[model samples]
Target: MWNSQSIVQQQQRLAHVLAIVQDLKALSMLPLLTNLDLIQEIQTISTATRPFIPSPTNGLSLSTELF
Candidate 1:
């Protein structure tokens, strides 16, 4: 349900992030990409992203019907 303008803005942000990741892989961090310290960084990012996820308790009702 995002408006077109909002979606475009988000897409631009993702593009910039992707560029940064590409730069990391191609320019400097390529050698360290697989270092053990990366695991801790990934865990930290996951922890930060966890709270924004929506839970099933919002307002949806469940149904047992299979057909």
Candidate 2:
């Protein structure tokens, strides 16, 4: 049922979410005390973004494992 344009849009969104997850992973390496708020925000963002991902098992394993 998906058209080409919608597929492209979903791919773009997946790319964006992956980038954010990467940045969050890097941020998570910092000291916990300093980055606690940021970590919480990352978790919130990760949770919010999960529904938009087309394939949870493949693309999001790292993010789910980390956060």
Full-model lDDT for every candidate: 0.63, 0.68
lDDT of 1: 0.63
Q: How far in Å is the alpha carbon of 14 misplaced in model 2?
A: 0.3
Distance (Å) between predicted and true CA of 65, model 1? 73
Instruction: List TM-scores for all candidates, in order.
Output: 0.39, 0.45
The digit string of per-residue lDDT tens for model 1 on 1-67 reads 8899999999999999999999877668646667556655555565564422323887322333334
Q: Pick the candidate with the highest TM-score.
A: 2
Error of 1 at 10 (Å): 0.5
- Model 2 lDDT, residue 2, Cα: 95
Deviation from native of the Cα of residue 32 in model 2, angstroms: 7.6
Over 4 Å off in model 2, which ranges?
Answer: 32-67
Query: Top model by lDDT, which number?
Result: 2
**Residue 48, candidate 2: C-alpha displacement in angstroms:** 34
